[model samples]
Target: MLHYPAATPSDPVDASDDAPEAGLLPRYLARIGYKGPVAPTLDVLAALQAAHIAAIPFEAIDALTGAAIDIGADAVDAKLIGGRRGGYCFEQNGLFLRVLQAIGFEAEGLLGRVRWMLPDDAPPTPRTHMVVRVMLAGRPWLADVGFGAAVPPQPLAMDSEEAQPTRHESYRIVRHGDVWQVAALIEAEWRTLYRLDSVPPPAIDYELGNWYTSAHPDSHFRHQLIAARTTAEARYGLRDNRLTTRLVDGRSDRRYLTADEIERVLSEIFLLPVRPHWRPAIERAATAEIVG
Candidate 1:
């Protein structure tokens, strides 16, 4: 079993806040299409999170293509902001954490054990997923834009057990024993998303998790093609070749994509750069055993 570090609220684990230069803030804002006021207020944080999930998509193309995943600040900025590409949790949340710090929001990174689709009898998993906790107006809010398909568009008040409405789904945070579990309401059933620890692990743990998730041969990201993006009206998800679109009003549609359509949807819908060398991998993932 993995040992998680414990810390009090006052001594929460802090990730590196060395934001790229002053110009990075503007570039990131432009990349996410956020034109709202930049401040440390809750409203601004909510707007920024909403805009980010809509703009910068979630993807694991590099892992599929057998490339090293870099979670460094400069690499994240270049790929997510400068390059026309999407990334998985570490890159997405890592970048968002830095951006929030740049905007002077009291924010830090948190780790979670993903239990989204695992069975009840499944064994314990590692702390792989990354999230953000923001302190504003004397309270903490959970803001995560890197959870792919079911990511919450708006920040959720950490103290509330009420069903919080977001752009797409309803999310609630519940305490179980010493841990907190984030769940989403799906088709009238509540599904656990992940289990989070209040005290964040050291930054080195994030680096290690990224390496396992992106580079390890047994990692699911290496075998699957996963991508997701959400707009104001609906949330789009692609697992392998199957594409699913869930509207805000509770209607959903699913369809499998051809190899040619895969390229189109990845480029046009998810806004990911389809490089020339990635054709073989794309074709393989498109033709794999279909599972929606």
Candidate 2:
């Protein structure tokens, strides 16, 4: 069974309030060097999605560094503006939601569970993801800019099987019985990305799920470090201390790095803010795994 909470509208802002029309969004986008137009239309959504994918990356470094993942808007703003780095789902989606609102799109936050890329019989682990619901031209669509490798910028129709084109890939949603599934086209084949029911989810509904994803024993991020970005032909990721780049041409390259080298690569290549606490945490987790 699936559960969702009601939408809680963010505090209202007066039109006369001169609190920077661009708000923290344009600056955050600028920090990541995203130079794009900001009109709220289908074409603009596509452009923004492309700019977002090319600039701000999906990452989990902060959670590994001992920083709390607060999904609140102000906290997210502080982290992006104050820390000058990227964040995982909570942070990225929180910030992206505000940007969508500022850009004149009607948007709301939604939550989802992640069913790993295995058999359909495997139970889904609920609250593993966060997404946004955007209303455009009287249609409700899904907008996610923080799904790490699954980020899709253009708002996708909530209940359609039409192929929506984005800069990164073409996406579609299908319904099987009561369950809805998201898929991405790769090599001319449809690949299941994840699935969710038509349940409305609220912000607080995700707190527990977020906590578990960051702290649970079996959580992938708890024991490994992963950061990835999509390029024209391949997806590059740092997995558990190894850097693996998968090319669209079906070539894969893996490299092992020392602790110091990992730190350097994370900061320099992945654009992560390497903190002192990260090394010990990664070491402890790796050591525990080795002994187990």
Candidate 3:
């Protein structure tokens, strides 16, 4: 179930005032480097999505570092805006949804089950992923900017089966019964990304999902460090001290980094500010598999 946030007609705050203050819109725009029209048009939607993807590094370092996390836009601002940092799905997409509404897009929040690692025939994964559905020109498009490295750079038509091309890859959403399966073309093969039902998720549902994803013993984010960011040319990622880059032409390169390079990747590539106390733990985490 897709859920529309509370409203008081046209007021950006009313749309999704999850942020502590209504004035966060301008900061959000500037942070993403968007200075174009805010009209509810495909151009604006595409531009915003692409700009956000380029500007934000989808990382779980804060969670791994024991920093506080909340889905509130205020927390997003505190963590990402000036910190030169990033967050996982809830923090990223929650902030993105508020930005869309503040700008005039008719946007709603939804949740998805990540099938990225599960076989098609395996039991459905939990609804742990967050997505935004925006209605523009009477058509609904899926605008997801928080799914990490393999994410598309623009909004995609939800009802169309045709592949939508982006700077890094081509993506398509296929429908089966009441479920929608999102897929991306990678290395000449189509890979399922995630799945969503017609039902929209409420805020409490997100809180529960966030608990499992952030604190559960088996959650991937609770372990070693992982971060990634994309540009028009290549995808850069940090999995511990291993740096991997995949170019637009399907060319790929991988190498392990020295301790100094690891710090640089955390600071420069991921655009994150490293705290002194967290550095030693982070360095050791680079090669160790953390377990509860």
Candidate 4:
């Protein structure tokens, strides 16, 4: 069994100042393009999950720019409201947890190891991802909108074989021994992506993991630029300067873009506002790969 950090309010919300007036939820919904009234139940969780996957993308530009990825509520709010952009697992899941709390859901942060689709013989890398566990209607569900391609919109019931629908792919959670694994159906076969035990993780646990993901030399985010978004039938990924889109039918298309085109696509498709300094950084990184 994996050890998880205890839950403690990392950044306490002050009822006097930081509390969102009742209207705050509505504003957030509008910002995320949610077209329905705020439901009082776990329906809000589903709505927020969909809206987040649709609106706030899964991006990793901060690692390229050497910005410290912070995982606190105030920091997440600043990035969402002030920066006017999306972030990777730490920022996206952190903000999602805060929104769940604001709307009266019992949620807690959880950590997981990423098993990349590289190879089976590769060793598992631990403590590099963050997700959330929510207690709704006397049951626990997994909610993760930060993952780029395979994000599901609704909370998936733990230990369930039921196929859950999202804005993207069909997902299911299954238990193998003491470990719980979330799998996606590709070509009608289940693929075990990552596993997490029923361990409650605190905000500080994610903060440390975020640091390594953003700053560690061997981390994938350090050497490459990756931003991905998911639609119901397809998933698009920009890895380094190569753009690839894979369909549910197992068809994939890939193309390499110039540095200028990469920046343009980031602004146009991904909705990221790039600074002038980032342009040269991307060019240098992409050119280095070509020259080497």
Candidate 5:
């Protein structure tokens, strides 16, 4: 089995606050595959969000490999950007938030509950999810690229309940009291992704939440091989040994993955590379899993 290092949250993770150097913006722009304007305008926000989803991905490799999760923006830059890998919500949104701030966007961090996969009768899950809220033209827009589902390819308006179209699907938001629920149109049925309140979260709150969500022994990510990324055509998912793809026309594809195939898919589908030294750990993780 994989030997997981002890998770300690005493270490402080700090992101770079200095303005980007001459070449830094180009490098980051290359990473996200976005050549569009870096302005804080609405058009720029939507395009950048779409480019992020297309370039980066959502993966649970750290959780699966028992690696400690670091939610800092610089950590995101080094790991996700330099490493050419994808990350979960905290990392993804953290990196995006810094970019928006650098480019002069009034982007704020918000917490949301994970209610998408739970049973309809189940109570609200913890506020483990993080999303970026950008303000443009006196309106708030949500930019979330970390969700595994095939949600709207662009940011959804905070005040609009109408279904907004994207390159892939249509999505809308509904406000209830202090909470705002986001849903996507799938097969003509509106499915809830998650819900959030307008309250802004401090940096420390995010740190604590990231620690619990990623490092907690009983956390769902630690035990399961969960990964997902969406494109204009389909949404790819991985759970244990199953690789599932759901397309836009409602047709779906499912397949089982062998250990070798799993590694390959990690590179090809999820844009993650398993270092030669890390193979044993991944191998052990697969063997220890009941599904494999």
Candidate 6:
């Protein structure tokens, strides 16, 4: 696990009503299909988060294809906004943080260690997840759109341990000393999602984490096909060749696709433009392990 810098007295979170990067705000709003007010209120934040998840997909095609994942501002804008590609945590949350800041929200970047799908006795994982911390009227709320399969559809309150309802599932944040463990309710039981540290990380941490996740041989993203997107009615997640649609009423439908069908699904279901060179990697991923 990579050690992150400790939290200091510096305030990295900022709000600017007339942000110089405001030129990108219009295009971002259009990409998400959001036509709401651009204020820094809770309503705008929740709407933007939901809209983003619905419009943009969570994917790892670059990693699967052995391509270097760039987390810089210009690269992120070109790939996610200008191009028809989706990205993992660092790119997703990095773009989201910029959008929020451009809209005059007081937001900061956060780091987390993924505990999702890990066994109870499993060793601690690395800090690879990226999330956003937003302060609205002095109350802190967690905003994240990068978690592939079970992303929170709405912003979660950080100070509460009660079950917070979202579009698909209910999530809660439980404090463990200085760390906060986030959980999602599934099959009537709460399951661990990830453990987040409150300290705001430096920008360089994202570049390092992105490289490790996309380039490391041990990283599952390089070996599997992970894609996800949510809608008003259901959340769709694709692992390897199997696609699962989880509805809001607690019902789910799963289907396994053939290698030949991967491209169609990637384009039609996930809304990602299928590239010709990605076919080889897609074929390998279709035959890889089904469970991660």
TM-score of each model, paired residue for residue: 0.91, 0.79, 0.88, 0.83, 0.85, 0.92
Models sorted by lDDT, best on top: 6, 1, 3, 5, 4, 2
Candidate 2: list runs displaced more than 4 Å.
1-22, 153-155, 162-170, 185-190, 231-234, 247-252, 282-292
Ranking of candidates on TM-score, top first:
6, 1, 3, 5, 4, 2
Cα lDDT, model 4, residue 103: 64
> What 10-residue stretch in candidate 4 is worst by lDDT?
1-10
* Residue lDDT tens for model 4, 146-242: 8876666567888577776554457878777866778777667666667776677765677678888999998878877878776546677777778
Q: Write the per-residue lDDT of candidate 2 for residues 51-145, one digit (tens) a residue.
A: 55545666776566655677677777777656766667767777777777877788777666675455667776666777777778888777777
Clashing pairs in 6: none
Better of 2 and 5 by lDDT: 5
Kindly list the per-residue Cα lDDT of model 3 for residues 49-160, writing each as its tens digit: 8778778889887667666578776677888786767888898888888778876789988888998856779986778899999987788899998888777777888989
Give lDDT per model, in order: 0.84, 0.66, 0.78, 0.71, 0.75, 0.85
Q: Which stretch of 10 consecutive residues in model 1 shows the poorest summed lDDT?
A: 1-10
lDDT value, residue 120 of candidate 2: 62
Residue range 128-231, candidate 1, lDDT tens digits: 89999999878888989999999988888888888987757789998777677899998888898998988878989999989889988878899999999988
How many Å off is the CA of 235 in candidate 1?
Answer: 0.5
Model 1 residue runs over 4 Å out of place are 1-20
Clashes of each: 0, 0, 3, 0, 0, 0
Q: Which tens-of-lDDT digit does each residue in 140-168 have in candidate 5?
A: 98888888755456778898898787756
Error of 4 at 128 (Å): 1.6
